[model samples]
Target: MSVWEKIKEKTEAGERLSSEEGVYLFREADLHQLGQLADGVRERKVGKRASYVLNRYLNYSNICVLSCQFCAFARRKREPGTFELSVSEVVDGAKQAVALGATEIHIVGGLHPSLPYEFYLEMLRGLAGLEPRPMLKVFTAIEIRHLAERVAKKPMVEVLGDLQEAGLDSLTGGGAEIFDAGVRERICRGKESAEEWLEVHRTWHGMGGRSTATMLYGHVETAEQRVDHLQKLRGLQDETGGFTGFIPFAFEPSQTRLAELGKIRRASALEELRVIAASRLILDNFDHVTAYWISTGLPLAQVALSYGADDLHGTIGEEKIFHMAGAKTPVGQTRGNLERAIREAGREPVQRNTFYEAIRS
Candidate 1:
């Protein structure tokens, strides 16, 4: 059988696609064929309703010591743009987000070198203490690992336990840029290792907590490496089943250090759709694959809904990480905008919580 025939049959049979198949689909398969296969899988797994959350992205600080090359969001401790929101400030933000009908407060930030552990705990406490408290999906595993080893001098389990006690709802999936160690080092030197990232999610999964997984594409990774990242997440989800979904981020190279290298540029529209389709085809064990509208832009993001992405991510009341990295998409979108986008794509828009629980059908 032809390579395309074999993959088509495998997908039709509900069989998992191999890494070699993933590479072939990424490199040679017809884009429309891939989209059809992925859309079928999306329909079976999540039906016709595309999903999003009423959430706000809150970055508490930008003072990061890890000088990642692809990050324009982090600042050295004394840099001019460095800022840290106080507990009261975070509380006020959450209050405002809640006032706007937000059900979740998505929090992530730099690995601040000197913030006391109490700062994190109190931040969680403050968010959890708000009226009509929003679900607090805060901290990536890397940040959690930093809080454990560098800041608190404790085991990750203990650090996670403390944050859980203080009302952290789930983990974020920002740091898993690429699982290839060589690529990781080139783009982000001091970030968490693949093992550390997986272990954090595994540990959280054990505690009945949920998290998302992501990959930064079109930067310094190959097709095989992208499949490798997906396979690792798939294997772990097979073991623990804690990941709520998978998100694909298109590398925006305008302000990042890697942009100076003539080799780096924004991923082509075809490349973005291919990555979204490939992610859905390979991650048979994962339920949702997000188009992540903030990075992909609403137009292409709408196109992606039919390409196996069943989630548009969320309202993203305010997001600075991608903006600092030169994303032209706005920091937030309204429910009206989100719903209209879904309807325009000929899909029903379902409002969801952080866990993908449908709040409004």
Candidate 2:
């Protein structure tokens, strides 16, 4: 049989795809054929039940130390429009979200140069103290490492433990932009290495914690790099079994250095679907693959359901990172809006908690 046929047989038989096979599928497989194979995988995993969480996004501060070329969200300490929320301010925003039925508060921020380590613990404590107590899904691996190495002067495991004790539910998968060293240098020069990103997550998992994985594609990376990134996440999942989901989003170049240099354009909708489908096939062990609406917009996100995505992320009220990067989608969605989109796509919409457990059908 042909290589494509062999890959198809392996995929349908519930087997993992090799890195070369994944690269082949990304580069050579027909789109429709790829979608069909990915849909089959989605079916085997979750059937027609697509999921969303009643979540709110909170970026506590935008004043970052490092200036990643692809980031439009971070501002220098004294720059105009740079803002840092005090602990009470953050608590107030999270309180409002919790009152609006938010079950999860998705929090991430730039690596502020001067925020004390206690600031994070206090933020988590305040959020965890809410009457409704939304799940405190806070911080990316980059932030965690920063807190540990620079602010706290502690080890990663110790820092993660302290945060968990303060009610951190899971780490948000933001800083794993692209694992390729060339791509990393071009985009985010002063950021953590791929191994550091993976090591942070690995340490968390070793402590019996769960987190998500993400990749920022459609930038300078080639197809092989994308597959390599996926393989790295897949390998980590195989070792830890602690990942809750995978979210691969497109690069939003507007208002960033990349766009200023005129080196790249936004990823097309077709390319977005290709990544989603390929992600489903490549990360076989992951239970959820999110078609993040903030980057793709709701229309394409809806279409992604058929292209192997089984999650629509969340309501995500008041997103800043993507918007600052020129994402034009609505800042948030109603639960009704999400259900309608899922239903319109001929799938059942299930409201879920942080861990993909169904809360409502």
lDDT per residue as tens, model 1, 1-361: 9989999899989998999998998899999989989999999998889999999888899999898898899999988899899988988998998999999999999999999999999999999998898998999888999999999999998888899889988899889999899998889997888998999999988888899999988887898999899999999999999999999998888888664533587898898999999899999999999998899999999999999999999898888999998899988999999899999999999999999989997
Q: Which stretches of candidate 1 lie over 4 Å from their true place?
A: 259-263
TM-score per candidate, chains pooled: 0.98, 0.98
Please list the Cα RMSD from the true structure of every candidate, rounded to 1 decimal place: 1.0, 1.0
Ten-residue region with minimum lDDT total, candidate 1: 256-265
Question: Candidate 1: lDDT over CA atoms?
Answer: 0.91
Clashing residue pairs, backbone N/CA/C < 3 A, model 2: none
